[model samples]
Target: MATSISFVGLSCFLLSLCLVCSLKEGYAFEELIESYAESYLTHTFEVSSLFASSICNHSTKANERESTFRVVDKYGPCFQPSLHRSVVPPSLTDIIRSDRARIYSIQARLSKNSGRRDLIVEPNSLGIPIIDGSAFDTLSYLVKVGLGTPKKDLSLILDTGSRLTWTQCEPCRSCYKQSEPLYDRDDSNSYVTIPRNDPVCEYVRRPVDPPRPINLCSYEISYGDGSVSVGFFSKETLTMSAAEKINSFLFGCGTDNKGPFNLVAGILGLNQEDASIVFQTAQKYNKIFSYCLPSSTSSTGHLTFGSQTPAPAGIKYTKLVAEKSPFYGLDLIGIGLGGTKLNIPESIFTTPGTIIDSGAVFSYLPPVAYMTFRDKFRVAMSAYPLIPGPTAAIETCYDFSKSTSVTVPEISFFFKDGTIVGIPGKYSFIEYNTTLTCLGFQDGGDKHSIIGNKVQRTMEVVYDVPGQRVGFAPNGCS
Candidate 1:
């Protein structure tokens, strides 16, 4: 009996020893994998042309002297303090839905067969009002600027797709809650209302049965998601900074406004149009503007107008199809991932062509192109374990909680003029949280491919409107 008891104890001791050894070995193996991931990512960023440009240099921060406004992510910590207490921020799912809605709205607007009735159309002006609820909400970037003589600071959405720069004004019939006080034209000495006979008045879309406010030039703009702004088009002293101010700047003062406009005061129109600040201040800035969208909400980015906008070394230029005026269009020839160039045909991109929008959060490719790109991405990321994303819209996701670092392949956009815009792994995949990350690209459908802000991160996007070309350079901001 004693010998049997002793034997059992010996067996238990041996089992415990084995378990301890296995745990230690497992921890050591985990450490090894983590070390490899870090080294691989460092090497990839160092060697890959997509990240090798001056823009990728961490040493270079955003230049404040020439920058018109410091761009901040709307949902980021830096901008959160400015939001109204009653305002509720959208969730990740809400953001994805709004983004898709915006893309579909763009497709509808561009479609010739679509029976959507027009709202506001300015024939002589750059004031083609784009109506989509997602238009304002999905715009993740905001810039602070002053609109009146006394210089009341206002936070406005910085959008390239939009034309009519507008803000909520006093004597509001209906107004949504905003971070700042509404602009009162009565308070500003520089405020000038447009007359009915002015050339700019032609830009205001006339309703079937016009409701003209006598001598005042009134405009009505609506979004698909049930957001609308109706107000008078007028000119005021536009103040960018203390050193920068433009007299007789054309903009909309929304007396009646309602929408999911978040906490923003208004929109900063950067489109190719007479009403856009780009064209309005053309002589001073030469219709050339460049901006760097921040990679994260905690960080800061820059938006610079005119010749002062920095064009760092290794900047690539691509032809802009200005025929799609309100939207900045470019020819997307092909796409490449890692060592392999994607098998998608050029016709896929050229059908409706591609437009790069600053308002959007995710890039949308055609079905075939998106699938091929997604499949290739999956294969390249096969080493990492697959995981479910926060939303169904984002299909490609990975679990990196166990690992200290993540290694992803480089995604490159090949343009018609051989201007290759290389997207680094960090920019290619969005880290939803510490544990999960998702591919930044989405299927935009057959109509048109839209390049959203996600892939444009870290690079300085230069829109040379007069030059009729768009340029991409590295290391524009932090």
Candidate 2:
């Protein structure tokens, strides 16, 4: 029996090895053989039986057995599927130029709108456009998500700060310029309009003219950066890849959408909201997701869902405070310069707290905290000569032309759990040009404080919603 099983497994392995070598043109022969040998041992019993069955019928139909083996060998995870993987492509670096502008716009909006002001819009005032010439152009990370049957690929901005994933659909009353073709419901076989009675349809608040039929649910969402999307709330087949296909996935099909959306199709919301893609696919993914934002714009990063066990060692964990809805909030207690702790008031840090956002570029602090940090930073680097920033937006810059290397103090963030996250000088001071380096921190006024994407670079930030905490580990993304 042992001899028979060994023969079967060996025969199957050799056949698969030869087939893979012929089909996979670029793969090394030795590597392929080694991989198949490992696979054969892992699925030994199944492969032995499968090979015996195939060999028995090989004389009559050899092609069928070869094809079956090919499919089995190609997708190892398909046989025993695990976590869903999605690739987030890098965004245009020129979008980095719009970072300061986005910060200004957000600050202005927060100043005028205050708390819950943007959410409390009257039903009659729905159509009235509040036009602020503030451009919504901001540095964004993008991911290509396949939706609907037959899979229409859409480029969406990956935002952790917002909820409700939306895309511009056909039958557009008004729309913005998109690089890709708009998603047409007619082309999708699995498309379904969500019934108004469904609990998911409650997100739609716009009063229809003369009250249209309750069968079609509608939605309206306004962004803090002055971008608004109003359209139908519906469910369709959402495909992450060829292997992963989600049915009855609810998403906003924007009919009237306007924003500084650039050439992208829509937004992929990964926030802590019921309507978000992360929450909708919680059962499949276990409410776990993580990302490592690359330091350079040239390199790409990954967005993974489900399974957080493979994380690297020495990850610092902190509780995700429930103060901010949708946005992930962390309790920031104090700021430290080198080894010395800054004497800024605890109230300043606690009042607004610190929100970790992937959408924003620069880290922001309250006015008092910012001034204290800036003053201390300046004093620490008093010996170095100052230079004009590459852009008007960056105020603090230094001349690094003559020196081989510039010595700058490390800035650390003190959290409530007595954990300190230290930022190296290289990360805190960004190289604007060949000879100039500018400070990455900005004053967020008094109302809001944010830890932006620039600060998060090269770090493995794990958002473990099921565990109700966020974990961070050094990943060399920079």
What is the lDDT of every predicted structure here?
0.73, 0.63
User: What are the per-residue Cα lDDT tens digits for candidate 1 across 208-281?
Assistant: 43334757787776655656678888899988777788999889888888776767888888887677889888
RMSD of each: 11.9, 20.9
Number of the top candidate by TM-score? 1
Candidate 2 lDDT tens digits, 1-478: 9999999999999999888877677556666787765432110111111111111111121121111111111011211111132212222233234554444544543343544533532111001122445343444556667888888887776778656778999978889877678999889999998777777776545534312344678787775444678888888988765566779988888888887665667877777778887898899888887766644444444566775544645678787887564568888888877745689888899976677877776788898998899888888777777776644556677766666555667678888887777665556755434455667787777756878776776666778886877878775232
Clashes of 2: 1
At residue 470, give the lDDT of candidate 1: 92
Whole-model lDDT, model 1: 0.73
Q: Which stretches of candidate 2 lie over 4 Å from their true place?
A: 1-136, 207-214, 381-384, 389-393, 399-407, 430-436, 476-478
Please identify model 1 stretches exceeding 4 Å from their true place.
1-63, 83-89, 113-139, 206-213
